[model samples]
Target: MSGDAAGGLESHDYDVVVIGAGGSGLRAAIAAHEAGARVAVVCKSLLGKAHTVMAEGGIAAAMGNRWKEDNWEVHFRDTMRGGKMLNHWRMAQLHAQEAPDRVLELETWGALFDRTEDGLISQRDFGGHKYARLAHVGDRTGLEMIRTLQQRTVALGIDVFMECTVTDLLKDTGAAEDRVAGAFAYWRESGRFVVFRAPSIVLATGGIGKSFKVTSNSWEYTGDGHALALRAGASLLNMEFVQFHPTGMVWPPSVKGLLVTESVRGDGGILKNADGKRFMFDYIPEFFKAETADSVEEADRWYDDKINNRRPPELLPRDEVARAINSEIKAGRGSPHGGIFLDIASRRSPEFIKRRLPSMYHQFKELADVDITAEPMEIGPTCHYVMGGVEVDPDTEQSGVTGLYAVGECSGGMHGSNRLGGNSLSDLLVFGRRAGEAAAAYAEGTARSRPTVAEADVAVAQERALAPFSGGEKASENPYTIQSELQQTMNDLVGIIRTAAELEESLVEIEAYQERARHLIVEGHRQYNPGWHLALDLANMLLVSECIAKAALARQESRGGHTRDDFPGPDPTWGAKNLVLSLDATGTGVNLKEQPLPVMPDELKEYFA
Candidate 1:
């Protein structure tokens, strides 16, 4: 661990510091600690409250508890096909091969998954999988996963710094130049600065969904890790591809963007228009045509006998489903709330609906005053996940920057253009362990002594952190206003569908928000100040928003989550390339370059053939 003694700020040292404390962070911390390294987890909120808790669907793994035919090869094919063949071959392959072990590992750690009649862990059907592959605990799979991991971490005696937000990654300036030395952070409760000095830092900070107006993400999903990585000299890949989950609650002003889990569809719910027409059948894309049912009878029958019939069109990958929903609303067949109707009430029995989707039932009954077991849900597309983040090694999860590793939602390449439903939890477990093991190994192998902290760098960070209060009595710009405007801009222009003109316009609007963010003002003292925290988060959102817009503009062809109205279709040349984003030398402008996709190994190539 690097030693720090600058600016009189509070400091702690550790062999590894894992940021975000979500499923990935906790899992990574466990692996690192087990690998014989002292580890600490830093989080913006209390432990177990990270966005992973909101994940309702189960973890995807070819466990074969429900379907004996399922295996890693089938899982790999589903992943690559669902991603539109744009996923990093190695990451997808590794995720498929290792996911079953990770899920079984969780079971050993005390996760109480729902079981089949024979008493094996229950597996459920989700979009894009060829078999019933998701191991779940009712609809609260994430809750169970987090609870189990949290218990293991406590049992292992790993340290945790709760409600701490890391603002910057500090690097060694002298002989160990460009390598991460530590991180500068602040306590959310007391608003006092704290520095975590560590030899290795793993980012599991999640996505950038909050950058849009309607989203299924929480405030913490402001792209802090993505921005931090760029500032620390790491590149971001495929920034243009942002997933809009097809089933966000579209009614009730307060719950406009709350997620309606895809498990609703997986469990026999169907998408219908206001005229009572099943709409997904008419909207199947050419890519998914071979697997999706063309008729309503076949679609319904597949739920009971998946092997004898094609899968329902409603079970298409998220990108295609979201686009279908968008097109339905645009074609004047929308629900009362400008969305489509998701009818589980008409398809499944009330007892089965309540038993299978208890959370969805309660979430709707309590929040929206609608019982999902009896009524159809008003649903639409809402920004949910980013299929892009810090570009990292497929094997190690390490970024280009030395001593910096990323996993889970903050790291890219696992899901190429769009993620399949139920895949995220497995992703956290698989790559999170790899990141931890690799980071520990890197730290153990380094011979460099503790690096010194420059007083100037500390001073600059302190100054910037407190800048929101600098205007004092004459403070003008409201941080919330800028944040809201930025969200509106992204939602309006760079949303599920995009055009070259709107993307260009979005860049201009983002530039204006960036200017306002610079002058953001916050009232009151630092202690427990939400306004001040949002002010700091604004910087990250702007940087991430810029990357999204610029990358969207650069990629003209429509593919997956990034749809282009002007281009209209995926181009073969564009399909072979990835858009990589980084900070220029000045750190004021974004640099975007196209790179060719990695070739799949011959051993893995047989599965596709």
Candidate 2:
């Protein structure tokens, strides 16, 4: 890999540099600045609109004020169970324990969560959660969280590099070329290039949501962090289990994969058949049958819990719920559009619905021309969070590569297979801070490391940016067309479920995409060239998808977020193998290896169990 940053129209340096100013990135920058490092937050969008703003549910944490039964141990167990036991025990433990402190810290920094009458932060029930432990604002919880972090970071005087995209990592070396020096990025507004020379770098660059055709992810969620890390020579773990959310609005092609917030369901909404009957009862898994309420009578009883009964059945885990909806539609009991109906009208009064779910009402009426309060909303699974990422020590958030760090959705082993609804927000706070602290500490004494950018690396990045404009490769297909084709292939094949036959085909298709990318053409100059940026992103997403599909094929036994019909049960022998994959300096190909699991101590075991 070339170590130099290309298109160096402008150049700068810093003590620490952070890519992507989303929730985790903002928080990391704050911590690094606090640690006395000169920090800069380079982002793709305007400060507030990074993917974090679209997070609709609440932040998961165990404050333990309302429910005495609630604590980090219970939260950890629920996370492991929700992830189907594939989550790293240590990561889950630390995240659960530290989440409450982080949420309270947000409050101290001016986040205003909804409050109970007694005035503690309010919590809500969400899929895969064992308690009403998600601390939230009305529905725009992620927006509130990121806004608060953005404010705090700005107040700290950390440098903000808005509308800039990092194209490569610049490594400095003392003949050996093994350590980090800084990075290269380009300005989006003026078409100017900049090289940020720093001993420390933090990547919190969100997900590969755009990799799927129909997704809740914005254009910014192109797995930038995932791609950046791979190029810098770090191994990504468990890329197989990408989470497909159960309730993306399925009508109006423009909004096809946009998310329908879970808050609707949390506020007494129900999933129904075309005949309007609730169907979750028939689909509860064995592990959760004890906590699941089976009948309408039990469901009605839980509304007040006056004559006391189990919690409602409507709150089942997301995977089981999505599968149930899929079955209902397959049995010809679906709405006209082939999706189950999500209705809140029957359960709550119009006044209650209007007040509690204003955003849902607004979004459906504005975007879909359907008033959610009066009409049944059309819903189906769509691509959402990625479960696999660069493997790190669950607590430290450090990658295998020296001086490299990952946080938020980009780091692996946190959610295991499927992440619970509210857990992501809390996990971001927990690990983002950990990664920032660790990176800052590493940068303190080791500021000038061995690896610095070599001229060859700069040329690789410059040519990489110029490839589409060169217009010499696949002249027949447009870059956007290839991108759309790639997303469809992944969605149809490596989506919610998987098989070895389909995975092998996906591999072939991905290879073809790599070849086609070489010939992609662009119509405009470097200034705001969406096509060029996408062509660049395709390389990353394709690599990420390869890791996911290949690893899915390797793990013959089903566990957590991975469900293979051919290999339907978790094999004890495969107990704790972490599949780690990385690319060489040339980005020619990849090598995957297995690393042993960190042993769980008694303290971790008690909490993990």
Candidate 3:
């Protein structure tokens, strides 16, 4: 298998292949290795440079270090409320219960989080939580977490294949069980094809935010994991719910879509309109009425005394805040840069600002040339995370396809309709470990002998991957043009606010892009060619875009990240179901199915009551 002369592909064998090197992938590889399975991690970029490094906010866990009253039950309740009760209860419960240990485990692996006065890990405030719960390190928590996990993986002697992109998941069709047989990938530097023959494949490739025009996500997130799962006969859940973070830098055109971490508002930043009014107070929804401050006095005072007073309206859940910001900008009350003003300069001391958000301070001072210590920063919504991906078993993290697993932002059901601010980090840790352990066990228990890879599948995969270089008549289509059009279409039509008409129009546009993607042209050879890479990425983006538009059109109600202007409220019937997307048996089209929500156990129901 090492020398496949027919396809000119190099082959390697491992018990488990983890197709990502971000937080989840590294953690999964480490766990699989510990479970006695030979493991390898394949990533498209250099280790430690995955998009996880861009995360600023801390991980959320009920460590009970900052607040004695905080516990997993409270965290679970907040998560459910944040997701508007659309979350898979078991996944949410597992995340909440296991997040603390995961955080502590990171610390043991040399992640130095900010320490409290009591010498414990420090916790900070964030939106959609009952108490201060984010374990941070000067707003660069992800960098520290990724570094620590990478170091741990190295120490555990796990194999890592950097700069590799997995194009397809190979499976055994002749066998009784259609389990994963291997994966086909190409080296980014050399453009040579390679295959990994493994009994289990774990897809930790992150979100699909790159499909939108204004996104905080990096280029690595092109729905690769989502598309791979779909084409591999797996289901995707809740694709309609895409989270738009409320605060992204709207000034300095070059950094227009860059993220402004929620830690700003968490640390007492206020949102104001051009009229100098705290506009968030007027935009508080009834859903948060019981917990939010209705007036400026209470809100300002609550910052000093969070125990007795309600939280500020500026600290509302991301979906609500993003919608309010969108409304403000549209109503001619926005800042000069077409966004709202976030003022932390007047709210906190300059020293505290620099200490707590060093990266944010540098980001503004260097990029926008505005000293955030003296002036407000203009910000708006940016596509940050997707609360949807491959559908999986809550406990095992295995998808519908046998021996295929997904974790991190690529897996669905943990965050439900909208993800909370700090939940993404913890979600990766808890579920990544779960996926690794489960995949290792499955591989060891079932894979008694080496699985066979079909030569026909390899031929088809190679043909599909190299079609862009064929220079056929249809190859005149430019990949960049189609990608840009698709981004703008998703951004405008299926963005923060949606209607049936716009979504239908988006579907039509997506179809056009899909057709263009088939004939995409790459001018240069494959070696380090970005055009060739994006040509491949466009297919995943278009497929995921179709799923989002179709699901958004079908769900005629507002819930969490998915807002329908035509149907302004959540429908009980829609709330009880999850929109599941899968590939049609023909493998040419997508099939949408509605799966009923799982019933919550009587014991867990008491928490909500």
Candidate 4:
């Protein structure tokens, strides 16, 4: 809280400025530093608590020891199928191949994963994986991952700015092309602004989970990276594909939708109706016929992998499982509550269940007043992750904004419409490192491509800094209301199994909320106002939702996360297409374009089988 609260009138320069010090952020900083660049990792939260710490599922990779026949091809096929064939092939290919090495690298950097009999890292079964592909550190896999990267990064002595929010991207006004110079940010502690100008800026700010009332995300995930990139004029892809975790705590609506881990399912939890009937067998598709187990005996046998039995199909893609559960509830076969029951109690020994799923048990007992070991938890889909984000090249992870790069959930089109469960952790690790390496490579010979602190840029940053104070003392319409409304609209209208009418209605509703948000107010000083933080987040949610809804409206086919009722079948014409979005004056938003998919080489095409 030192002296100047004059907003962003003051300016600083660096070799690289990274927003969001999560797992991806830490990895990016390390890569940049190793590549000989002065680096800074800025964050809105205390070092280790970024949303990556909250991720409970394991990371996906083909360690291949458990199943010798396994390779990147099977992993790729599973990803495309899990995403309902909406996944980008090149990204999925790179993600699958690089994941094993990244996980091993983390182990070298001090991540202690659960071990097998031979003392190597162990793998486990998760939904949508053909083989046991996910390597984990108990249920707190993401936590172990972030902490490992954090410690390794500290050893390198990289610069870090905590509790600073990036308000705008500092674009190079010099006669340079589409490249960016760096960025400007708001320091929350002192309520001042700091301009960090660098040749490269990497955005790993997670997702817009904070915009929704019910989310698995924490307070720090405000979509800042997406908003900053959008305003800076980089096109986004697949905005319509927002994923809702199939299981979130239901009763005691006050606490809202906290996530129930997928690991519970991996540990033999059975999804049943109130009458004690298992319904997933009815939903298995013919496409998955070869691998999917049909009967309960066959399903159980899949666990042991008897000399000749088929694997369980109940572990089908997340989108498929979520839909199956939704159908159960709709057919009046649900529990006393609206959700289908997930019972791990009867399937496995109580001791094994407790040891493997300690956090799930603890989280439910502490937060929801229920023990999963004894009772089946109530759950329904809530907006969880977005598959689409700032469009970036496969190798570089750089968006159209030359100096700006994206990684993690903020950058989209990676998962297409539906992401497989463990791939997200791997996506962060693999692509995050690539982005860092590429950005650092670009930053090596590049000097300050723009003015360090030109007068005009400082003026705009200063105005941004004083925005909360500028509104009259009694600013109305709480920002949280806008946030809640956003979640409600998206959940009710744009959720799983949507319609043209619903999408159009949601678009109009989002617009109305956007107008209402204009009249929204921020109270008190900006020092630590959660309210002001929420207000800024509302703008991002509004704009991002508009693109999602518009893309949903335009796509006319049911594929991946974007399901339209009028068009119930997947249209072949739309199979290889992508929807691109950006912000401009008219509010009509950016138009759709048919971006080409990577031609799968003959060698790679064999993986599709």
Candidate 5:
């Protein structure tokens, strides 16, 4: 924890530095420490309060605790199909094969998941899974997972720098090649600049949901990892694929984008429009027709007699359900609030509802004044996650840049265009460990070729971070105002449904925001100043938003999370190629190109046949 102060910047050295404290980052830190590497974790929040705690669903795994027939092969097939077969096959296969072990490992570390009648870990049903495969603890699974990981982290004596935000990643441009050197950051409490010098850096900084007005993500998710990777010479994959979760609170104004966990629907909840018709049945796509129930009787029977009938249409992949909700609202059948009704009270008993979804029961009662035991909840599609992120090697979780790695939501290609409901937690555990181990190995192997953090680079980062305070209060543009406008632009144009005209318009608006952001003015000083922090975050948000808009405009077809109204059907040609975005040589604008998807092995392809 020792550091030298030079040019007003505090510098600390470590073998591996993880730039997030969520599930993936903490797990990576633990693994790096276990591998005998000096590790440090930097996070924007307290130790146990990263945005991972907001995940209410359980970890997806094929432990077969609830259903004997469930296995890794089945989980693999489900994940591939859920992502519309556009997923990086190797990543999906590894995630499915490794998820069960990861979940059990969490239990060994004292995760306390709910149990079945026979005392094995309980598994619940979620959208796009073939069986009840989500290992959970009521609805607080994320909170429990964080608690377990954080406790293990402290016990292992892992160093955690809480309330720290990294603004840029420094690169070592040697005579032979360029490599990652360190990270430039600042403390949120005191607002003092700090630099972490590490040969290996893992970015687990999560998603880009905050760029949208209505999102389930916290303010910390302003696309920091995505932007950092791009600027540090890594490419982002499938940037057009932004996931809008089917259920987010749409009422009471204050909590409009708060998430309503999918665990409710998993435990017998149904979605209905104002006409009291279960609208999901009408919206089931041709892709899932073979497995989804067509009638209410069969749908209900499938819950009790899984072997005899198809699963309910309400349990379709998230992309399909979200689109259906959007269509329902566009029509005149929406609820009083601009959403559809999710009814669990009528299907399950009060005690059962509370036992299975305790968070939903309390969230509604406290935030919206609606009790799940009494009435249906009003929910709609809200910006939830970005399936797109820094492209990384599926085996090692290392990005294209040497000495840099990414995992969880910050790294792309695991979930393709749409992620299954419970897969995020398991993905974090599986790839988090892989990235940590790989980062440590990279650090150990690169001692001689280790990159150095130059004093000149540190000076430039400091100047760029302090640009917002240059012209004082009369700088014309306010950071908050610019951020609000950017959110509105993304939400209105590049949302669940898109068209060429709107997508083009959004790029124009984003360009305007990027220009305005350069002249942003913050009122307060550096110490504990939220406006100043947001001023810095706006740069990342603007860059990532442009990538999303550019990719959305380039891909002219409908598939999974990315849908275009002008080109309403999924094109086979477009489906086979992924749009890769990278910062051009000038480092100002992003360049877009296509890369063919990795061909799946013949044996694995037989699953679809």
Candidate 6:
């Protein structure tokens, strides 16, 4: 609501504009402000209530606080291998090299991490880590991370527009190659429109998980950034790699898909079938077999003696564990609630469980009426994260479009095909700072020739955003119904395990949903209307769903988060390539093209060799 009138529309100008208030967005804003740039952060939720607070595991970093052998090189190797070697080598390298420094930087900015016996920042075990490498604050690491970052942002005096939703990216038509000039947004409270005019825009808007029916994502994660980037002529990479987390609550209907943090498994939890057998050992892939324990005895011994024994199969990458759980459910070995059992009760004492994973313990006790200290929790795969997002530069996080940047869960290539648990927080810090610094530099360079927001473009965006309100009361199409159908379509056909037939059928259903969405009608006034807001968000979800489905079908190989039932194994040919999604010429459909993966230097390739 704070802006000056520009051509009769409310407009605010800044050097850099960040489109989220999560961990990445806050870090970016702080970085830009420190670099002497006037920055503005716009978010769809309150300051401390972003989906980032929902991250319960620790920040992955090679601090080596607990393990002497841990370092950046090992972290790099683990990331590349965990991602199935499809990662952009430079991004993975940079992330690993910088993560420790970023974590320590958070402490300097007043983050209070759990301490080791020697008084160093404590590091804990997580899936895909070669050592205990997660810097944590018990199980509420993300909550503490957000608290620290929010304080840093406030201390820097960066402007924040809370409860604001961006509907479109405004491009400057005057430039020979169109560049992002600003953004079109609306206040979630009053439904009043506002425009942010900036030379550089950083999209830290997270992922597309909410498009699926059962997901760990909050309602605000409707793929707004992905759709905005596509419409602004930026391409998304690896849209097929949608990560369904292995442990989402599945017992009670209401809390189904709520996340069960990886901390549970990291702190000695194990997965079991209905017959009370440890099942993850049977699902370890050939690639991971060399480093994974083949028997229960060694896996258990690993907890106390890390130097000699291989890690547990329960600590495999998310995609592997999720697929294993899905297979167990389908094979009739699942719990009564149609999921596998995640038990930490028998392995660890009640006091240890509460001290290590207080959040997970309470989440189950309050929501599902299950006690983690005594019984197993019924859990299954739920759409958690999308490794696909705006394709950005490895060093600066800038997209192909000038003056536009993306970071965190809204950017691709850093995680490649699968993200290791705890790595997400570190990715946000590393890339968020790079993007903010780069955006500030770009904004300064363009000060003399800043792109102008065309009044005409703003008018078009406003019309599209307000269209749902004008539909008659008797209109047959309902926004909520269309959204529900779309979610079910994605969950049923394009979920954890997919087939060519189901993928094709999903595309057809998506098209029908699109038609229904076009005629969407909401029965409410513009002010504080949830239905109208959903109507606007539906467009983003539908567009992103098409990208996911099309990319999944075209990939034609099983790898990482994307598993094709017909093509059950990873194909060498597809492993060396990436699929990029862009808007078609008409800007009404998506087009996909195969691009060669970035070649790793011989020095770095030695890790895989």
- How well is each residue in 267-374 modelled by candidate 1, as lDDT tens digits? 999999999998888888887788888899888788777755378988999999899999989989999888899999999999999999999999999888998888
Clashes of each: 0, 17, 0, 2, 0, 0
Candidate 4 structure quality by residue, lDDT tens digits, 265-357: 876777777788877888887767777788888887766653343655557777777778878888898766577777787777767877788
Off by over 4 Å in 3: 1-7, 307-309
RMSD of each: 2.8, 2.8, 2.1, 2.5, 2.4, 2.3
| Model 2, backbone clash pairs (residues 3+ apart or across chains), number | 17
In model 6, the runs with Cα more than 4 Å from the true position are 1-8, 472-475
Write down the TM-score for model 1.
Answer: 0.97
lDDT of 6 by residue, 1-609 (tens): 112222255789999999999999999999999899999999999999888887888999998899888899999999998899899999999999999999999999999988999999999999999899999999999999999999989888899999999999999998997699999999888778899999899999988988999999998999999999999999999999999999999979998999999989998999999999999989999988989999999898888887364899999999999999999999999999899999999999999998999888898899988999999999999999999899999999999999999999999999989999999999999999999999999999997899999999999999888788665554578888888889999999999999999999999999998887877777666677898899989999999999999999999899999999999989999999999999999999899999999999999988877
lDDT scores of the candidates, listed in order? 0.90, 0.80, 0.91, 0.79, 0.92, 0.92
User: What's the ranking of the predictions by lDDT, best on top?
Assistant: 5, 6, 3, 1, 2, 4
Compute the lDDT of residue 289 as modeled in candidate 2: 83
Clashing pairs in 5: none
TM-score of each predicted structure versus truth: 0.97, 0.95, 0.98, 0.95, 0.98, 0.98
Question: Per-residue CA lDDT of candidate 5, range 1-609, in tens?
Answer: 012222366889999999999999999999999999999999988889888898888999999998899999999999999988899999999999999999999999999999999999999999999999999999999999999999999999989999999999998866266679999999988778999999999999999999999999998999999999999999999989999999999999899989999999999999999999999999988898998999998898887878553789889999999999999999989999899999999999999998889999999999999999989999999999999999999999999999899999989999988999999999999999999999999999978877888889888998788888774454779889999999999999999999999999999999999888877777666777898899999999999999999999999999889999999999999889899999999999999999999899999999999
| Deviation in Å, model 5, residue 353 alpha carbon | 0.5
**Alpha-carbon deviation at 406 in model 4, angstroms:** 0.3
Better of 3 and 4 by TM-score: 3
Top lDDT prediction, candidate number: 5
lDDT of 2 by residue, 203-289 (tens): 899888788887899998878888888888877988877777878888888889888888888777888889978888788878788
